[model samples]
Target: MIRFVPADVGTIGQKRKQVSRACNGCRAKKKRCRHVEASPKDLDSQIQAAQLAKGDDRIDAINDDYATSPTADSSTIPASTRPSLQVSPSENTRNPVCQSTMAAPPQDTLAPRFVDGLNPEGVFLAVHSPQDTRGAFSHDRVGIWLADKLNSKEKQNDRTLTRSWPQSSLLAGRHSLLPPHESIRNLTSIYFKRFHPILPIINESAFRSLGPTDPAYILLQQGICLVASMIPSSKGHLFLGDSEVPLQHREFGKRVVSAMRISTEAGVITDKIVLIQALVLMWMFSDGPDARDVSSLLCARVVQHIQSLGFHVYRKSPDQASHYESTMLCCVWAIDRLNATFHGRPVLMHERDFGIDLAVYIDSQMPCTRLFLHVISWLDKVIDMYRPNAELRSSDLEIPFDSFEDLLVQSQSLRIPTPLLGQFIILISLPRAVFSLSRIWLIFSPKATIETLYHAVSILSCRPRSFNTKILSSASRSRRELSAERVTSLVLDKQVCQLTYFPFVPYAVSLSLSVAYSEMRHTKVPMLRARARDKLQINCGLLERLGEIFYLAGLMSDMGKSTLDEYDRIYLTAVEDYQQNYSGSCAALDSIRATERVEIIDNSNAVPSTSREFESNNGVNGHSLLTQESDPSFYVDLPDLDVFGLFDPNFNLDGIDAYLEGNLNLTYPTNF
Candidate 1:
């Protein structure tokens, strides 16, 4: 019925006009649109291609099932009212249009299929895998898997499992592994009060909040217990409820190892600041024949952790750091550096590696920490000056003298404002003794040795009377407080007495004594020689006093003990020789007194003699008269006594025992 209208054909080469039309939906919405007509086959092919492009093959099957099936009510609906199957080319890439001949499923049935996988609910369920056991993840199972992956054949064969994972169960323990909570609290309080002022590493609040099972807290607790056991006060009846309390140090050390194992199993050994703090405490408490070895190993481990944490390069961000972290880093660095110098091992870090400046830190808010940092810096310079391979030129040794003097001045000026008076005194005394020791090592002269000896005395004097009296009083108190059973049970205790509050005091005293002994033997001036002899006696007396303390503490260094024993032999020999020589002098004086008596008898009536006339006429003090008779001015003019001995190459401590012993008996009290 359509009439074909004749086309108005444009002339040849005329431009053709483009045609466009809007789709039904676009037209309903009144928006501009362009639509292209597609054949049914092409539309079907495009829909299939889109379904395949979605990467989920399930979509294709769903589409096919929908296409084949129709609800009973669907046929009643007109096909013309249905949605179109065609899609624009632009829409094909995003959402494909499918022609559905059946009614769509209920909204609830289709809602889950369109749920977003990235949503929290979806992600949690996927990770938890409620539907599949094989896909589930749990912390224990994950830990086991990690352990299996990291556990190597060599580790298995050696059976030396430094890492904690596989043996965690064995390492874990109940309350038996620790003291009672109250005991732990007391020890921890003691540690923070005594050691923390100098080494402020553990955060008090955080440490308190940690549960007993936490590896870091347990390790810290064990360290605290071990250090507290070293205190004389802790060994008394005050903590003697259980038989085990006295030997808690041994148990605490084991627990520390166990805690380290746990931390290693937790895969946080080298990552924890608390572990480093614990190790530092352990190192400080360690002593024995193997102390050097233990300290070296401990220091190495600490450095490893410190380097791993990037603390050597850590700089403060704009945000201020917590007191715990900053103080811990600073203290650890100082400990490592000092340990290196002491052991003659290579240092783990240099001054430049510090995040904070040592000079500035010395002047900062933490006054107690200043002494440690200052001493560490000076020790670093000392190490540099005396490195093993470096040539000991005169200039090389001379240059550091100024620095040493400056350190002495600085240390002397420091006023520690800490409640721990004993620890504070020791900390302040250490640098001064170290400076004196450095001088003794660098300059081998009587002047230097005597000066160093004087300095050692000064350090000893700096200790408050309370500290010295406490040593004697504490020993007696502990013996009285501890029952015989408890005292006997402490057999395993490795109590070590530091010879001086500062380590260098013993070394300086020994050197001074040796030098004084040499000068006493070789010096030509009788009075000067006598003065050196007196100095030797003074040094020996100090050694005897120190030895008494060491004996009471049940602690003595090999060096100190040997020095004491050798001095004893020398003193005994000197006393024996002096006694023999004094007997001969007494015989000579007796003969002279007899002759003086004869002279006094002959002159008594002539002079109407007083006691002064008797001494002037006959010289009744025969020993003085004999000395004057030998050399007129021997008793009158005395040479100036140099305390530090001459650095004579031929000087030796050999065969000086008689001289030392004689002078010692003269200058020292017989009770010593």
Candidate 2:
């Protein structure tokens, strides 16, 4: 969840301290207590001085520290409540020092002073004690109310809020004259009604200066409107599967996308980031087939724009990494949906036939696997928007092995390793994307249309291979078996590996799946159509392998569901350990767990352990020892090292396309 910390926390703290001094001031005034020289009343001059510097925004200043200190001694008061203070110019003119040293006032000093029309005393009191204006509510009560109002405003400001005013007097009288709905009321009404709202807070004059319809402004406004349309944080229907906390702001990002419609080579505007954030929001809450469509389009657009700007290389990569994160992950997510619905294939990058020709194109590129995993995670999160019951599953989202061969071909045989971090990320992500897309597809597709089903399946069949090994290694096992084993491995590794590093293994898994799936369905054959689009018959063997890959990927994704829970356990353990330190309890258990987690991270680093004797006998230099230690640790633990971590899932293990994952065949054409 995105966190918002007030930038002026220190200021707020200081202000809070000032608010706490009122009692001290009162005690000094009553002469009953002269212990504290720096009373709350003493701070008022400082606050007033700061206010003067900020211009005449007295309302804000008044609201800022209206609350009285809670630690006041009310016991000395008579059984009857104290009368409220009256405001008047005379009250303000009263000697500041004298007021501080005077006997106890009979009322809440800050209360608005009431007056008879002609009474000088009453008028003086009324003008000086503005707190009394709120009537009946004490200074503290008023402060609490204002704080709530400020909080609500803060929440509204976080989103892109917009308003439209009626131009004519007749319309203004009917709508504009009506008391505005409370912010919470407006937000909740829209969420339940599924309609849009235009709760503009800014005056219409400022808006007009922005133009009748600047795409940027529209985009900004749209983003705000979406935020406004969300359920008032505290009103979510938890029984209906809504887990959003009450009154806490949740970004309804999907709704913001409707405002984005830029189509140019001009440099991206800040609005584009807002648009990307919206897409990310969609990926979080609305992962369905439709969501995939939108996500895919966004990805394609971002990539094309970046490429056009000659930002294909890491050096040329856009400074805005977050946007790229959305695009790359979106592509992975889109394809995962296709895989799930079609039961067909992964569509990873390495599976492309571009020929492994790394060159500068390799820089800053997320490994296909890692990118795919993130996309799937995004998709899975959004799936709840369409299908509450839907959850991510890894076994059902595997990438075929043949796709890795495709990557090799694209890179011209760069010989990239199989099931590396790149592959793992792809594997973990696929299921979520698939689940999200499936939920969406079921909603909008014609209820009984074979064409829709065919379309979904076809798209699934076209997905890229996440791993080269889908083509490089032959499992000789059923899809179910592959899933079981992969899941077991994931759980086991997470338990044994360093928790901090272990989480990253999912990245490798995602990469492998993306590569493996990309290859099975090759771009030459359109997978979505019911009729044959390719001259060649569908490769039955390849299709079956791809299906198995998908299933396995789904299983892996399923395991990811426990990631947060596991993280919480670790977090709690750490917290407990911290508290125990103060209590003088030994933290041996925590130390052991922490050590184990570190070792796992080392293992994932793929380092090898050499006995001290062997190292000395081999006469390896410290540098070589260090390098070896940094290598993947497959040799240390896996007895079946030959097959256990072999073969890049991004390559075709079956060699259907006959290419290595990273062979880098330079002769391949620049365009190819």
Q: Which candidate is the best by lDDT?
A: 1
Cα lDDT of model 2 by residue, 1-672, tens digit? 997644332132244532222356666677554343343543454343343344325544553454452312222223233232233344334334323323332333222212233444433333544443324234434222112233334446643232121112222222221112353344434432221111112222333366423543443344334433332222342111132342222222222332233211222234444444333323222223253354445445443443343322333333443334334333433433433222212232322222222232233343432332323333333222222222244333333432323433443434323322123344345687674565321111111111112211212222212333333223422332243234223323422211111111222233233233333223232232111111111222222222221222233333222222332343344444444453332245446655875897777854345544575566432223223322123123222222212334543345423322121111111100
lDDT of each: 0.45, 0.31
> Whole-model lDDT, candidate 1?
0.45
Assess candidate 1 and give its TM-score to the true structure.
Answer: 0.48
lDDT, residue 192, model 2: 25
Superposed Cα deviation of residue 332, candidate 2 (Å): 9.0
lDDT of 1 by residue, 329-398 (tens): 6777777765654344677777676666545445452544554455555545545544443343434432
Cα TM-score per model: 0.48, 0.22
Count of backbone clashes for each model? 4, 174
> What value of lDDT does candidate 2 attain over all alpha carbons?
0.31
**RMSD (Cα, Å) of model 1:** 27.0
Q: In model 2, where do residues sit more than 4 Å from their true spots?
A: 1-285, 313-474, 478-480, 488-672
